[model samples]
Target: MATVGAGRDAGQNLCGCCDDVVGGLPTGSDLDLLREGLYGCFGGAFARELVVLSPGSIVLAGNHTDHQGGHAVACAVGSYARGIFRANGEGRIRVGGRGLPAIQLDSADLDARDGGLDDLSAMVRGMVALFLQRGLAPGDALGFDAYLALDEPVGSGLLGESALELAFAQGLNNLWAGGTLSGEELALAALRVARERLGGSSAPMWQLPVALGGIQHLSFADSGGAVAERIDFDFAQEGYNVCLVEVGDGRVTEPASCSSILQEMQAVAGALGAERLGDVREVDFMMDLPVIRDQFGDRAALRAIHFWREDRMVEHRVRALKAKDMHAFLELTRASGASTAMYLQGTPRVARSQAIMLGLAVADENLRHEGAACIHGGSPERAILAFVPDSVYELFSQGMNAIYGEGACRAYEVVDEGASAWWL
Candidate 1:
């Protein structure tokens, strides 16, 4: 059996530069945010003892999982999932949380190998199945005993829970098999098992970027999978800043809206037979206005349109980064945020927060406000964020700290290294 511990040296292995960028201690507010998000998404009572696995590890695993039509992006943040696990030899699984009843699932049911093992718990089971299916193990000889922990109080815009699951699966596989896999391999393996065995809904697209770190553009076609291209942008050297601002009013629901937007965008792309909306350049807005209106009538459609166009802008940013044109890059980033607010009709909460952040940036004597940007359908509470050069991070951090109070905004040094795996 695999018995995991919250090691004494936990968090010590974190990159010093990352710690410096996010500031010292992980805030309590961050943990609260994560707890709330976990309840909302997973409906578990609560999470405790959060654990943050290295982003590098997750990224490496995610990349290795890539199939003909799969790609993932992930980031290792300052926070992680918090919880503990104990193996029950009685062929039963029991989970408990605050203000919630303990959830029990029989190990017999899990071992059935039927399609019913397709829920969250099944995700863990699927990893085990994959290990055996791949001939990496002789049998399900051991069960998992684990405790999840987190430093970040709240879930970031991305599906952090799944990220945690990926990390846990990786750690468990390593421990049980007494062997190591590259990060990319683990990520791909987990993704495949999750989709095929656990019935996960999302495409394997978003997983890689978060795993790998740095900015990336992803594309998926047909039923094949997806591909990712790293956008070569240097936030540290560039004279501008990138920040993610939270719109505290809470109108934005990322998972709910992002899926709809992606579906609509896909339909448009499929109908046009173009890779993305930006491919339809030089068309008069007035000429396409009726079609655009018919297809995407609501504000959500407008937001999707903004994403399509901004995707093209991201391509431009990629070029500018290559050319080392800092001015152009900053301008594009700001323009992207403007597009989000004006075209996409971002939530009022997000708009207000962004305006507040912009004001703070402008007032800063040392830092110039290059731009503000928000992901489509990002959590309304944390709607808008920005990117800034490393030179100005120190100068601008204080202003953000004052506005965000604590645990609101964070800064991280941009790393050029793409995703890869390391083992202990």
Candidate 2:
């Protein structure tokens, strides 16, 4: 296995360096595919290819609180999306990846987003919009040609869109802006891109880990500001491992079940005179619980309660991790999952995804006290995060994989160093 990065400033050819920097990647990351895919349109690799890498993130704790301007703890995982960029001097930005057809558009014309934030084309447009807003895009932009690749495991449910955008923007920053922006600054630009696309209301906290790859305890303020503190601790030293469990696929996003939870949470927030639960004091919310329930019904009140508690739990979870208090951290994550499921899970979007409940059940029943599990996020999450003692990792991963699907259970570490975390 090798690191298949696009050649940098040394006039590295995309096809020439395949054997050296491409094989170590995961699915959709084969450098040959990138070479063939690019060669199909262009003749060869451009001189001085600039390679960029960005990691996909997971919500380590604190679910459903981002939109409320609450706290969250996230980690950038080993899964990654990569970009090989070169200045084409063609006044056009062309972006394509393996299995993603090449789409060409004028760089100057990237003034509007063409699709959703998750859409590749639209994400590129969003990135450009942020770049332009920051006066980062050059006046006489030569544009760029980028061939992107990804290393995330299939069925892991990671959207590499943000990574691709970060890689694109980071490459442009280096080529045009003299690489002046810090990793966190680049991440903030990416977050702005997503917020612009999704609007200012939705929670996009996962952006922190993806753009600034590492373990971060993030506190987002009501004014739309953020504070990211690096949680420097080693799980390996504690003899534990964290894995993302993919329950099922094709689970539609924003199903009624998921929307209902948000709607209910918002309804309660409105009743309390705050736009988000995080803005309201916990004691104030608790005192008004009876009234909130009478107005929005019991479920709405329950959801609001979960929100305030989970928001506080997020901070505690970060403390537990920093202090190496695994047992405390493990329990908090589990309780958050329980609260999310009981008060906010709403219902399953599809018949198959009902397996979500079953998956949690299975984990709880089999893993016992030594391990802990939690649903990853709302929108009727199809994945769960499990922390298990490393001594039993082999049996645990194998057993879980047999129940879900082979390779559906992969272990990951807190990737703080090397190219995997280079985005930040």
TM-score to true structure, per model: 0.62, 0.86
Tens-digit lDDT track for model 2 on 282-341? Answer: 788888888987888988888787887888889888989889998899889888888878
- How do the residues 48-166 of candidate 1 rate in per-residue lDDT, one tens digit apiece? 23323433212211111122122323333333343433233344444433332334565345453444322445565666557766776434434433433433322455223445555
> Lowest-lDDT window of 10 residues in candidate 2?
1-10
Q: Which candidate is the best by TM-score?
A: 2
- TM-score, model 2 to reference: 0.86
RMSD (Cα, Å) for all candidates, in order, is: 9.1, 4.7
